[model samples]
Target: MDLHFGDSEPTDEERAAVDALLGPPESAWEGADRSEEDLRWARGGRAARDRRELLLPGLHAINDRIGWISAGALGYLCRRLTVPPAEAYGVATFYAMFSVAPRPATVLHVCTDLACTAAGADALCAGIEARLGPGSGVGVERSPCLGLCERAPAALAIRAGDPVRTAVSAPATAQAAVLAASAPDSAPEEPPAQRAVPQAGDPSLILLRRVGVVDPASLDDYRAHGGYTALRRAFALGPAGVIREVSDSGLVGRGGAAFPTGRKWQATASQPDRPHHLVCNADESEPGTFKDRVIMEGDPYALVEAMTIAGYAIGAHRGLIYLRGEYPRALQRLEHAIAQARARGLLGDDVLGQGYAFDIEIRRGAGAYICGEETALFNSIEGYRGEPRSKPPFPVEKGLFGRPTVENNVETLVNVLPILTQGAEAYAAIGTEHSTGPKLFCVSGSVARPGVYEVPFGVTLGELLALAGVRPGLRAVLLGGAAGGFVRPDETDIPLTFEGTRRAGTTLGSGVVMAFDGTVPLPRLLLRIAEFFRDESCGQCVPCRVGTVRQQEALQRIVERTGAAAAADIALLREVGRALRDASICGLGQTAWNAVESAVDRLGAYE
Candidate 1:
């Protein structure tokens, strides 16, 4: 049975809602040199040629600027670009990021790419939704691509604010100064409630804010407001002191396993090796999480500096950023930032004249979620299909072409520069015991304000839901992604700390929170998840490949025919869930049963 469903045609009300979200398509705020002809070309026309070339680019540009492209706006774009409205709609729908429906206050994008889905993106979406309420102020969106594919299942948070206007100028076009008679020197102020904390006020806060914390142009302002001070401080302290400070800070890995970073560094540093390596795991494939993308786009230097510090700490002379090929912009920015750092002598040999040599190179992955796993990532770096390798001699002992290596997620490395600069105890003071510092939770789906939120570990799910602005009468919560467990609405009261989630029979796998209201059918949701697993499974293991297929067929049977034997099917589902959990080879096959288990626990009667 085909599980892919077509979207319902937008209703009149939906069209109006979409229009309201996207302001007037033609604005005086646009560049003066831009002509009506340019607008016409951008809007698209009926001609096939005009529709493909003229209209699609314009729609993409509009979506990039507005965070969402509306149907009404598509009509306007068709007129401007000389393309048909239907063609524009087709292009918009082709990309998962564009939304025809009215946007909520914030957009929480969960990466549903293969890697993230396998990592537990589904559970994260479900958990956040259950806590917040479905389709609340936050609109949780699933993105097919965010370019951070190596960082599989990444997510991003875009909040609704005043439109950001930019001038479009061609290379040959003369610069025209068209000043409005009453144009304010400063941009119009956002309402007090909408304005988030200033991204530039504190250095540590700036790191958190850099995760889509603010605008790109504002990055120079961040640099001016003491962005690289931490790096400078690290240079002063030398590598050993930097390692000591990070160790004291108690910062652990933001990747699935919460291992202490400083200890990992110490291991590499103590190793008497010629070319020890530091690698930034930009393969954030865990679903319902996109915090790394924000950091990469908003503040590339923070990661650069953090990696530099790691290079110093581990006595490594070179570093490699295993960035996903999907994140083209991020790769570009990182490449630019690396050049800038090298020019400033912050990278390269004798950085800042301290005689400490370190440099970084970017290695792009060809869209694999399992590559997020260190061993698999290493294989990909060596030109192989991304797949996990058996552990014993972990990445630290034997990684990256058999060299002693330290691999860490972008967020974990981003925290390093700050912790090294600020004392360790200061960093440890933010979150609960064991899990120190603020965690960036990519909360999406059915919430009032779905976005990337930084909360100290140990905050209750209820509190996070409140922050997310979930609506009333939440039905269920799917913690983690497909790999996570499910909790009913009553469990929202549980604390969201790692320990707390563990106590509730769920691991805080990748910190993705998704909530859902009663509008979503639980059985249908499980079936969708089952189908995804069956399609994406690498088929290396019997439990994952066959089990997922079996589960999908069984669920289909139940959904198709409801009878007295439905209970028997549900029991069979429970048994399959347990088997997959126990017998699977890798995380993909292993945690594939999370959604099924959760579904059976909460809404088994529907099966």
Candidate 2:
């Protein structure tokens, strides 16, 4: 396919033709050849007036027809749906599944969003470049959303063969096919080992079985296996009961702050307003936190149920899922699930025929780490700079067009359905007093098995590390993400509870447990993190923006002047940490020092 750029504007007739071709009203069901039976089943009169409304089904049908959506086809869609060119462009850009550009012979989409970036995604990108060479047709694109934001730095490779067409006046002879088939069975069948029953404790086998990565075909399949039971139970008990049960369960936000989820809901519910909103914060950008991605990708219905339940609890008529653009697959899954829910009359007005109305719209973010912050996220949803605003008038007081909004992280919302379905006491009984229920810990780094794992909150770090298959003679554990702390080898014996982690001079921020064997040098690791902060700081605040660069230079000097006297830089590092922590305007700047401070205390010898 040839790519082109045109400078001249189209004439009035040309513009009208383009508009007529692209507008949804004009071509509602223009190309669709659905049978009367199919149309009846879908309750179709005409196709949807807003093609954007039909986006999920349209993309799915397109993918089903062709292995991938060609650029020309997408352009055709732009005209057929009557969708504004910009809006159509936005939709195509927002979804990872639709490639507006030409499909490369081989496309490697690497995850460079926050989580993957933290887990050495940059190094992996460099490695790919080194192996594949730069500017090669082997396309390596940094995808904003693969819906596996938590998996960070994950990638999907797609290979395309040149399109071949054979002009046929008549069908080919069966004799030619028989002769070709008789030539060879060169393609290998399943290996002998495949015949053997797979053993337990194999990481790959466990991931396939337990992770629930594949999409469920029907709501019945989902329901038969503990799907919307939570929603059913939630509706039966009513909204107040849900609020009370969640409160009693003592569930905290899994995003970062660990604030009480029920309390946030209550604050939003108390406000007697017209359009209170419930937002599921699926922008899981924290380094080392893939638990949210797992939930969104594996069991999206749980989130849908949870959000619907939250809407009921808060009298919210509309809900929004502010998903990061980096997670393309997650976004696609969510979009599909939302459409399915709407089709079943579970999402729109009079949900379950209960007279309560709640509809969800998925909004994509443009790769901003600050948008992970609740306030910053709110601004992004409103189409502004994704920078944090002051929090006295928290989102609960004024959010999303000056309405009360409850924004819970993806995992936190996922837990809500389970808590409401099961008794609060059941959840409360699982974890420590202050920290209740199971926490999904994302284990990464040098561990033999690195992935998201669920464990009771009170479990010890040593136990989690052992479960993660940490190597013997491990150096240190980086608990949480780049914003979290470094725990010494001895500190692994400490319990993994919230309070326990705090007592050990670290917050169990986002439950990211990264194990490091003794291979990588401590100074280099610190420098890498420092440099990351230096590059990522939004420059909104003086301390974080300027201080991170200063810290990087100081650490670089210490590394260069490595000797017994390099210990003097330790005090300077501590000072910088304290200043940045104290003077920063937002959480990004404020918490940026936590890792550095904890690392200095734990690994001063390296400095």
Candidate 3:
């Protein structure tokens, strides 16, 4: 944890790990052997300084090969990237996944978030911890959602080595978790991504039609399944024409904001700024939200194609997909899909021989939820702490290395495919007038068939739950994730539209629909939600950093009290929640109290 580089040196293994990503150092200034010429003149100016953006990737190069970061390895990475030791340490420590201290070679991440808890994650964690005793060469760390809510009580085992080994145990038993931790390579292969799509082969499905039916590993399979048709149409229409079609289709962002996609593209495209950039926000860290994960895993080609179209439309030659680090399967599938596309002339310079040069780079987020915000995501990609920047001049005006940038999440980008292929009028007609196009819902918790569902926007909450096979004794439902509001079971009549959810005092945040029964205590659930926000806060702003802690503390006190006994703490929660919502820098703090407030007002958790 020293702020300055020390005499300690990285081991041979550590040096090779870093070198693999950064290549050999050019001179003694970059951790190379000091030479006669190095003593006379100094190296390091704009070029060396510009490489600061490689700091995160260099840290990953170390952590991915070794179990945890060491002071020596951190110093070496900082030296190579021309970053200060203190700043590099700060960035490395900002994420939950990276460890700057020594630890076992294998670590087991047990999901303790809402859906997993509903499926008994606490007991599962206890059993796993008891099974993997100290000196067992395995460490167990409780994690937030891993985006595997459908098969709750999920555990991810990662073993550090030359090439890191990983395994997933979902709906996990203690024995399976321990085995995965001890020997990840020996664990059974994970189930196909399509297993998470209940209505995979249904003809009615739009976003999910190719999920269970196609061979995800084969790009040819994707092409045969009507993939790339949208991109070709985009090429024909040209940038302006493509934007017009999207505008006419009325497609909005699926990442809860519901911002008009065409308008965003138009703004970014029209920007006089040179070298505009495009970014795909694939970091789906919200608890109980896994629809993006399913799309990237099952239909990887769709996202690649969509990003290509988006980049072309915005006149951006480069795109980046900020993928979450926990999604090993999704990452693998997407990597393969991207390489295939690049090799086949679908990506890289002069894509599709259309004279439009564009390509994408995948940046893995090191377990920071705030990075899901567009500005924070930009900061993360730029190798800074994943903190949100103040808006306006907005992203379209100045973003991503101070250039105009267009950013959209996985689902929003994928929606572009349908909009371009099906014609604007037809696509707009699928859903209601305002909430146009089909939506993907991540349905889990107390449902017999929990999975990601693709349905038109106008469907009622009751209708969606019925399709998911809601279990008996349904007491409440969380319309969104932790940041979203809760609705009583009786409120299922509420329509699942953007306007409808807004009118009903709820949000279709990332299309999360988690059902809960009486067996699960609402008070305890609310406490966990509060804890997630508190832990995920970046501590950059006072309102969020302080308000989240106060919110959690008040909820902790009220969880066991009822009626008048809890009245004081409930009021405290409201006061603190209001401060957070009004003064917080980003959405994380702004909506941190939504689910808790809803639980108190609508579900009568205490009274």
Candidate 4:
């Protein structure tokens, strides 16, 4: 636990993990054995400081190799990056995935979030724990949503070794989960990405048209299906023209904020600041939201192509994807797609031989939902705790190492492809006058067909649910995930758009549409949501830190009470909720109470 040098030396395996990420340290000062030259000069320290951002990746390297980060390994990594030991420890402990203490080499993450809970995750967890009890040489950790809501009760197994191996078991049973945890390399292969897309072959699809039709690994297949056509058009249009086309399309962000994508791009491009940056927020951590994961796994090239176009439009030559660490399949697919693009000159300097330079790098988020926020994502990538910075100096003005940065989610970036290829006028006409282009909705929980469904923005909620075959006796629908609100089943006629949802006093937050039938317990669901907020709060500010905990406590107190009996606690909830929404710094706190409040008022859970 000591944060001082020489307190504990890294073991051979730990040292190898750090060295593999940063390459061998050049001098004795940089974690090498003490030597005469280390006393004369601290030359390597300056070089190490320049690469401080690699600190997170370095921690991943060690954790992936050993399954847990040891104090010795963390100290060694800090020395290599010239980071203070305490600061490095803070970053290491900030994420849920990383473990600083010793544990089993293999760990199984069982999803217990909303969708999974509805599908009997409670029983699955109990069974798995009984099977993998102490001394089983495998660890069982209950996790939040694994972004596999379609196939609920999902389990992800990670076995650390020379090459860390991962296996996924969705709709998981105790036996299968234990098998995956015990022998990850021998676990069954996951279902293809297309399986998550119920409307795979539909020609009406725009954002997901090529998802299942083309081979994700083959660049030729992607191009034949209209892959880099957008980039080609972007090159012809030039940066300004590309921005103009996007602006004309009326495209807004798909990530909850619903900001105009064109304005963000224009602001970043117009910034007098040198070397603007583009960031793709691929950390799809919003519970019950997996549309972005489907796109990355099924059609990764589209995201790569879109990022290139976005970077070009924003006067940026470099783009970064802050992908969540748990998406092993999506991660593998994207890494392969990027390598193929680089090999074919679709990426790197002189992209498409258009004399324009652009490239991308992926940074894995350990396990932090707050990192989905633009500013927090930048901090996580910059080797700090993922915490949101105040606005005013927004991302477009000062972001990503204090430079003009344009940040968009995967779904938002991919929308640009249709805008450029089909022309802004055509794309704008598909949806309502305000909410343009197609939207992907993640439908799960008590639905016959649970998957990512692509529909035009203004489709009624009832229509969307009908496509998914909503179960009989539906009670309520959760539009958006834990952060969104609840609506009675009778209110399904609400239009599914940013403006429409706003008018209805709800939000189309990240296009999450979870259903619940009469058999499901609304009280437990609300309590679970409160627990999620409490667990995920970054604790940087007092309103969120205390408010989330207080909210969960209040909900827990009222879970068994009803009507007037619950009135006192319900009143307490509203006061805490208002404080969180009003005084919190970031969206996480601002929206923490949204679902709970809606459940109380709309569904009347207490009464």
Candidate 5:
């Protein structure tokens, strides 16, 4: 194993995280033969691809251990996974989260996008910099919205071997927190997060009923409060029966693309495959959305139980939860819940003594927004660049290591729990005929009590806003996320359902309702949205890569001028936006200009 990359060597911590993903690195003590043990560990083309699939995870492990990926570490990982050094390097440098050059041990990522900006993220970042001073040995930088609008002005603390957590976090403790991170043997731990328990004014309160009411880490507590009741019912009905029940429920994906979940499960099951993969799209990176985080953190078992049911229904032996890198709390809660389930015979070979083997592995995304797309997600898991693949041989036909995979968002999977427990017909009767089941609305920004509120599909945006304690003097509402459209205050009565949102020229995408009063400047807000799309394009396609940059530039000019120049820039913006929407490969580029275009044309941001 004569390996040559760079002069640098991975630290012990880096080596350990890499080894955890793809066994120990091969040692070549001067012209050593291909070791028998290494050969056996990585055997067959299938096994080789499997080993290669560990590339991203391996890289993540390396970065997780060390602050950045050094050339020596990347080369070691490439050799271990049998991947090309060039390809591995390309991957290492592709994501915003990964850094190639030497940097400080602690990288404090302060959120300065939309919701956070409104909540004083700019002031917080300046305060942190002021406290750290020059050559503080700590690195501080601004990050996009961390899907943490619920706790606005959030900052993530990334230290070697420590879970990424909100740093010097609270709006009040911003200055003190930064000083602590820089001080000697100091860095007072962030105060425990005071999780909000907003009681939905709507009496139904289904999706959020268990959120603040249950011990997320306790399996017995979940079971006592009707947890595995869904799984038990799933067992009673069998795979076909369970699929049928889902079909009857009219349940659709909550991560935008309201495709029916039951049809996808059926398609994956119908494929001639012995093992299928179930992926819970826990990568909730859509700006202004943190509902998935709440579900995973407060009601972790619901997700665990839901995933098992999905695996059983789709004939999958394994499940993968692609969690976001910023969600350390959710990750911890879900991991503990998984462990508890495995210990209780709820997840493992012969789950609940029903002879159905299903297990979950949590894979963290290294800050790639495009990986939220199904095909891109698969590619990321398979050790390739996190770029979206062409459709036709859709995910159901071939996904996840080139096998049939049924992918569902966190909210979509959790919906399965209630569907099975209460029966499909009963569940379908709750919401509108087209959009069924309860929904989690991540209400944040310019509101009195920003939090997650559950409502039935037909509930209006106005109702949701009022429930979230929106203050007077409402200006505009950015529905969905950065990728979702905008609606004026008058349209607050628009029903927050899939079809209703469509009729109103918007989407109930992941149920993100950001209320903006007249105070927050829309031009800068729209510019931030444009900048996010430009940075997260992945550069795999020409349209998105170039169009996003053009869009941002156009918004900049428009923001700079309000007369004829702004008018001309607005037209140019629309042209570039149309190109991105029509020519881009993935949903990211397609919807890149959604918020800005809606803000400009409908809400009159710049003009």
Candidate 6:
């Protein structure tokens, strides 16, 4: 029996979408069955040649335009790009977003990750699903963090007519939440994509000053509010001087590793190679990390300007923003920002008439959280399965297509603008000596005001909790996202800096602070954390794959009150976590046990 019984054929609209990418598959394709030009166009023609390395982008084009990747579309794309069908399918299926089966025109992705779960995402999901019913034109799928921790119980709706997904910030009210997508596309008065937050003003805040104040869609508005001031500064200093300033600022990667930014740029710039690359790690998939999404949706030009400066300093002509598939609003805003920048002679060739050419291309990830890793991100961008590579030929010396590439996350890159404009010394003066500059912390869960907060590096957890409206009777806090550790109520006095958290035997991982009140069940939360690791593990290394599974099983046994004592299960979990940390290839495996280990040992969740 054909399981795909009544799947619909690709609509004319869908075909038109793919045609835009492959450039009107010659008339010969209809008669020759795509055989005559298969090799020539796939490997030789302009359509396939330059874009073959952009396999991930090609898939994104199809999915975004058509709502799903069909079997026929995949085959046609494989022939056009010269990628084997098996390889293409593997890449597509590996991601959570790329649906092989047909889907409704509008798909509602409900957040079910830790942050959302705490905010009653499970109830929200169940309510929406019950209302919609199965086989409805509107479909619902539980998603990992959609990067809207601040607006807990959020969802992203992918509509046919819209260019990007519609982000539903607060969807817990009623079944009206599902109405977000059920409405016909034509009934709209203005395109949702054109909608922008009205700009307001607050000069007191540094990183977030422009967030709510600027009309994110207006390039003119951005310019009026002192935008591009950093780029002009960069051109004056030249690439070398800009690198020196950033290095002096003592800024580090905000993706939790704290690697020096200026050192990375200097290494990439000093590389004796041509055609280097600058990759903006916009694949912000950490469960509670939504600062990048807010920045992109609110102040996108900052990232564009930052990428341009990065390219100039690294001596690269091309820049790629590897955006997460889940962040449709960020992707749409960035797409507009890049286009606007190019039209204004800011992004494309000979930028600022300085004789240095640089451009940025946005590539949407399929749905692999592991792709958040630098190496895995590179592999995904190159159209391969998202997997991490062993280190020692770090990204600075060798990255993204065997050329020296400097990859930084959204927060890390945006910080560059302030560092260069404010002067490294001034910027460095604000934060702790080792952890310089302002940081964006994602504060969510059980708080009155759950959102992204900007603060200097050394702010204490107690202070942050107060700002976020911590509920009384607090039991503990999940200091980081799933990959981070937990902190007991007594630990609120601990500073929130990377070093401070480490000294307290936990990590300020990915700037995620998920607050938990006494009402929440800690054991269940730990089990979910374990389950996330098990599901997200790429299974590349045996330790991570098997260890994550074992860890989850042990946690499950404890949660179910299995014959095994809580102490025995906790001990078994630690043993497995240690193995994963010691033997795993990438951070996915190495840090898989952080949340579970912390909850059991520090928070006494097992008891």
Least lDDT summed over 10 consecutive residues: which range in candidate 1? 168-177
Give the alpha carbon lDDT tens digit for every residue of 392-462 in model 6. Answer: 89988889998899999999999988887789899999889888988888888888777778888898999
Which scores better on lDDT, 5 or 6? 5
lDDT of 5 by residue, 1-607 (tens): 4435766665666666677776653443211246767545544434444578778777777777777888877866765666777788877787778898988877788888889988877788888888788897788878887877877877777775544333435343466557545542354543333344477333456766776567777888888888889999999999999999999999999999999989999999999965789998988888988888878888899999999999999889999999998887788898899999999999999899988888999988888888899999998887888999998789898888878999999989989988888889999998899999888888899888888877788988888888778899999999988999889988888998888988988888877889888889888888899999989898989999999999999888877878988888888888898999899998999999889878876887765
Every model's TM-score? 0.67, 0.74, 0.99, 0.98, 0.93, 0.92
**Pick by lDDT: 1 or 2, better one:** 2
Q: At residue 605, give the lDDT of candidate 2.
A: 41
The RMSD of every model to the true structure, in order and in angstroms, is 14.7, 10.5, 1.2, 1.3, 3.1, 3.9
Lowest summed lDDT across 10 adjacent residues in model 4 is found at: 1-10
Instruction: Give the better candidate number (3 or 5) by lDDT.
Output: 3
Model 6, C-alpha of 242: deviation from truth (Å)? 0.8
Which predicted model would earn the best lDDT?
4
Which of candidates 2 and 4 reaches a greater TM-score?
Answer: 4
Query: Candidate 4: global Cα-lDDT?
Result: 0.92
TM-score for model 5? 0.93
**Whole-model lDDT for model 6 versus the true structure?**
0.81
The runs of at least 3 residues in candidate 6 whose Cα sits more than 4 Å from the true structure, single-residue gaps closed, are 1-14, 26-50, 160-169, 184-202
Candidates by lDDT, descending order:
4, 3, 5, 6, 2, 1
Instruction: Summarize candidate 4's per-residue lDDT along 128-173 as a digit string, tens digits.
Output: 9898777998888889999999999899999998899999998799
What count of clashes does model 6 give? 2
For model 2 the TM-score comes to 0.74
Q: Which sections of candidate 5 miss by over 4 Å?
A: 1-13, 26-49, 162-168, 179-195, 200-203
Local distance difference test, each candidate: 0.64, 0.66, 0.92, 0.92, 0.82, 0.81
Which of candidates 1 and 3 is the stronger one according to TM-score?
Answer: 3
lDDT (C-alpha) at residue 287 in model 3: 94
